[model samples]
Target: MESSSSSYLNLFVQETAFYNRIVLGTLLPDIAWNPLPHFFQTWLRNYIGGTLLYFLSASLWCLYIYQIKRSVYVPKDSIPSNKAMLTQIHFAVKGMPWYTLLPTVTEYVIENGFTKCYSTINDVGWIPYFVYSAIYLVLVEFGIYWMHRLLHDIKPLYKHLHAFHHMYNKQNTLSPFAGLAFHPVDGVLGATPHAMALFVVPMHFRTHIALFFVEAIWTTNIHDCIHGKIWPVMGAGYHSVHHTTYRHNYGHYTVWMDWMFGTLRHPIDDDESKKEF
Candidate 1:
């Protein structure tokens, strides 16, 4: 058992020094010459990259979903007001710095060899790599469901941290921008599951990073209020119900959690909900 555990531990640490050199040394060749500490440099890189990814992804999705296919997916009368969208944007912009900290700290942790992240699939073999990936996602899904539920169930936590997000509880009050328009702490807490999964699961380093960014896009998709009606998948339809009712469909990527917890509410229950903004 000790030898087996040591072998896995070595795999986690094997690429740490190499990745550290690549990230701190050559990843940002320009920053390599900068005098700021490595931590700050990593934070700065993640901040800029995250910001661009959020804006580009959100804006394009908004254009495609809210404009290009607006007629097919959204009702003219159900459009969110400019004030509502602006408010969402304002909150998102303000909270971005705090949100960036998760990735910054994650990278720092991975660089230091604290998590069960292997550098390549070959390190664990293809079969184990695939199995681990599935397990990692399941762990993340479970964590996010409970974390999100707690944000609502805990009175003090909700009143102080999550109330800001619930402000846009109506369809017309929601937009792609509202996806990340969370209180700084609320935003970080919501995504804490991804970081938590790292410590518990053996995940591919690049896959984990990609999944984190995929979440930014996923949030926007769900907030757009266009239910694709894909069963089991928690599309915007189910998310729309969550916004209006606030107690059902709290699952992140799938309905399995909500279904298992007896909190799942189908969007079809309300015909009017089909036109949610």
Candidate 2:
């Protein structure tokens, strides 16, 4: 058992080094970070990479949804003001470094064999890989559901920690930038499920990393207020309502949680007409 654990650590070290050398080194060669300890490299890479991904993805999506497709998605007089967007961007940018720390620490934990994170899909076979991935998602969804709900349900948690996120309480103030416009702790708590699932379920290392990055994209999508009309998905439409009502649609990724918890509010049921410009 000790030998097996050591092997996993070795693989983690090698993979992390290779990633830092190839990916991070190319982008941040001046930093001379490749030779640093694996933990530091992970921290640097996640911070840099996460910040870039957040800005780049949010910018492009904002362009498409707020500009290119504005007439198609954004309702007349419902477009967020420039000042509102800038505020969201400010909060998001300010929170990114602290938010990235969660994943960096999560990687460190997984590297030290503190979590059930496998190095590769082959270790668990194809069937189990998919099965485990589903399990991880479910665990994350459930955890985030309760975490988000409790953030509102508990007065102190909501007042001190989560209230910062509720500043954009309307469609006209919400935008792609509002996605990560959370207090550092608020944003981290919302995503804490991803890391927490590591200790509870077997997760593919690559899948875990990919999902974390994918979250950057997903959050932006759900904040755009453009309903994708995809059933079961907790899309922007539902999320827009959540902003206004403050008491509904606390689920992430899907509506199953809200539905089960009796907090689900369908976008169609919302009195706000989905009128496009």
Candidate 3:
């Protein structure tokens, strides 16, 4: 009788475990809640932080640009007020979309079946969050670096599609989204490729969040023109050169690719070969 009791107890425990897995799986894929709440909290914090940083950095850059404009382009007799200059900067940056539909579409694609190879990364046991993030970052960066280089190659395409961004002929924090004002072909080719990389690479939620922040900060930094001698050390000045000349400096996140392919240059050099225009 005691032996019979032991068998029945073991069977009951196994059945309970099986039932619990079914319940949890039905509710959440990883037995975890959707992180939309957490994502919003983090996004709000970053948005606030980014706004503060952009204000200070952009102000300094605007003042620098104004000084350059006054010396080279503006009449010596008319000194623009700081308020007037700042208004221009504010309008330029604010007019562009801060949050975009491309990212939302990319996320929806990932949640659906656009690219499913990355799903296995979530199942890898013993992998830490940071490791997964690092992998995704490397993959996305590699993809973007190549795609940006490709965009600058075809002349007819570049002029018609990407000409609006070069319209600035100078750098500002507002320049990244400034491209949004471009032809629809430019928008689709320039932004969508990198946005879609997320769907191609299996990324964890943490990695996706990190990528968003990194891309935003880097994009703003590349367009800010106040880097001076400190810019090259931080990899910020090349894009400014690209703006001024309109032909070189195509890599989005890093200069290494540009350097390797003979596209990198100093901001003031008149070397037309280095210029992408």
| lDDT per residue (tens digit) for residues 1-277 in model 1 | 9777667555544443344455556546754535776667656666666777778887898788778988987887777888998899889889988898897788778766688887788889999999999998898889989998999999999999999998988778888888999999999999999999889988898788779879988988899888888777999889888998989889999988887887888888644323331
Query: What's the lDDT for residue 229 in model 2?
Result: 76
* TM-score of candidate 2 relative to the true fold: 0.94
lDDT score of model 1? 0.82
Give the Cα lDDT of each candidate.
0.82, 0.86, 0.50
Error of 3 at 149 (Å): 3.1
| lDDT of residue 244 for candidate 2 | 83
TM-score of each: 0.86, 0.94, 0.55
Cα lDDT of model 2 by residue, 1-277, tens digit: 9997798777877776676676687787645885777788888888888888878987898888778888888876888899998999899889988998998899888888899999978888999999999999999999999999999999999999888878988888888888899989999999999999999889988889889999988998899888887878999988988888989999989988887877888888543322310
Top TM-score prediction, candidate number: 2
User: Model 3 Cα RMSD, Å?
Assistant: 11.9
182 Cα displacement, candidate 1 (Å): 0.4
Tell me the spans in candidate 2 whose CA falls farther than 4 Å from its real position: 270-277
What is the Å distance of residue 155 in model 2 from its true position?
Answer: 1.0
Candidate 1: C-alpha RMSD to true structure equals 4.6
Q: Which ten residues in a row have the lowest lDDT in candidate 2?
A: 268-277
